[model samples]
Target: MQEQSDNKQPLFYEIIGPAVLKERIPLYEVIGTLREYMNIIDRSYLTLTGKDRLSKKEREKYKIIAYEFNPGSLHIDLAIELYEIVQLVFPFMMPAGATGLWDLTKSSYNFVKTVAKLRAGGEDPVIQEDNSIQSYIIGDNNKIMVNPSISINSDKIEESVQKIGSFISPGAVEQVALKDMEEDGISITEEEKRLFNPETTISEDTETIVVKIYRLDIESKKGKLYILEGMEPKDIPFQIIGDQAIGPYIDALKADQLKVNILREMAASLTGKPYLKRVLLVGFPGIKPNQGKLF
Candidate 1:
């Protein structure tokens, strides 16, 4: 079990929380929560020095979502595990359970190679990245994404809404109380320190970021599956009908119209918002090369 020494994975995480708070998750939030979960699983003084080993339970508790440099695409596979994700974003009781949905839900967060890029220099524009709903959060100031993935209810989930509901009011009061201590200079115990660590706000320049996706038109060219002189050709998955038909697998993939429209609407909505100060079309993984000739 080697120590987690920081691999490079840039990510922008949005967690829709209870009482309707949709926010881009910072790296510190991930670190702070992971620190709490790690300490709970195993931690002595040696743990602080980066010599700690993760146990089986600890490994299952966190999911590492790193950005992959797929040659021509900047896209996530988009299969999300709700529970494990919550522990990283909000390592509290009943992650993704009824109360957990309110605790944290990951929705449409951008993945990058590094967080420092989000903190880039120069007159960078910011994107608020918010969709507001009335009376949902902060007296009509709720600026979060639409119904989050974690918010969907299911019998398959393993948490009691009752338990989470019980904690919300008390938790809010406690947070407000602790916030007051910032001015008074109160000391937090070691136990409270991990779970209650406050993240300092970053510069306003980095507050908002915009990502623009472009649609591309590709020309289908004649592709040949050439084999070596001494080698045998592997069995093809589909029958080749002249140079026109590629394979059944290729034919099986049809453009998802609903999803395409939804994505376009999302990009358009984020184009101008009060919160985000910058916008960049960093990667567009959804853009794929068309194998079929234009009709």
Candidate 2:
């Protein structure tokens, strides 16, 4: 498990300003509009070192959105999460056309790569290297993209929502409270520390929210298999078409039209409101439904 030392805070920029159009737009058109107004979300963190030795070794990034609104200040928890919600919709609205649609529902890697390049003196590693890892990132391969993330802090849930409504749609969103903290020991590097801090208003910037996007291709308990590679177990029971494999998990893919609409409505609301600063949407693995025996 090698660790990635080059992690940095993700940036979400808006290509389109907050303005809703009366006409209904196609998915591609939405993506194109978002490209014009790009929004950056999510920050990077250390995973493991790629030494192939130690107890753990693999350089990767972890997703953790941290926002600091006066660490010791009094505020509503939901307001902060709402603030996070505002962060989520902002990015989705901008990258509505090609970039957004292409990377749509896939993952936030492309969005993260774009930030890395912007922070790296505008020198895209992918542009210099033919096999740059960033090439796999959805939007980076061709153009700018948007990725979104969602999370509600339990203790700060109330505050997050209220404050966030000021930025996003002023509606009541369902907030589910969890009993325990889902702690995953994701690592972070010096560079990532600098990047993550400002985006969440934790250490540096106070006006930005960070997000990460991921691919929702498989079930939570099921490991992913590249069907085209013919490496899956014969009992797995699946079919491969082009680069994607149609397996039990494939059924979960949300309809493109539906996804677009959901995003569009979100965009319209956030854009319509002028009280928000920016929304950071992070992409990641989609939640898989349980296929066990029904009760």
Candidate 3:
């Protein structure tokens, strides 16, 4: 439970299957993996301090490290962010053990709120207030994660897609697909025109509607594996190092389905208990794996 900070390092974990009987998925193994990833990052990024006014080699190293860790590795500062993202994706993945998942989510959510509050008055807000307005509509973190999973269904997915009809702007021809809609001067379907035509004059009597999002945490060995629609998905593993290893270790535990099963098998092997069970995907979102869809 070491605190994550900019000056320190962080770690992430994944569990594939049953929670109980896990070990080859041990804490230290994850910590070791993280250490390797971080030491290299640190060796390059550490400050030039006191006498050392910064060396050319050090600066070059820092650039290389930054490039490697940029969007993939969960660095110290981003540990909490990643945790919040995980919670947003799966609200109840962790158990109500000594330290409850809800409480953890609340803590993380509050931390973001506090930062938002501080940022609101600053010269520049690091994160746009409206960027996460969905969090406000959903209230707490757990609600944000759960509501969307249940609300999104196969039937509704198509319905909503059809109803929304591409989030286009005024005077735009409705395109056949979302991508086509983005292009200029594309023709739209009648249904799409009616739903999204900004030019259509509406009477003041029109009523507002609230669209609810369904919570989903699609679980499977390939659950984490997703296609980013037109783009490619990056396979970035969590790297944990130093005192902040726990977070990444936990993340790694949550990532792989087979890892969880291995942990359970190991636990059973050691304890010989017939009922040492642990729930997997405690709050998994049931988004069907539509390989073509954007996660």
Best by lDDT: 3
Compared with the true structure, model 2 gives a TM-score of 0.18
Candidate 1 CA-lDDT value:
0.22
Q: 2 or 3: which has the higher TM-score?
A: 2
lDDT of 1 by residue, 144-227 (tens): 222222212110111121122122232221211010111221112232222122122222121111211111111121111111
Which regions in candidate 3 have their CA more than 4 angstroms from the true location?
A: 1-130, 133-142, 145-295
lDDT of each: 0.22, 0.22, 0.24
How many steric clashes does model 2 contain?
82
The list of candidate 1 runs beyond 4 A from truth reads 1-56, 61-70, 82-103, 107-136, 140-295
lDDT of 1 at 121: 21
Question: Where is the poorest 10-residue window by lDDT in model 3?
Answer: 260-269
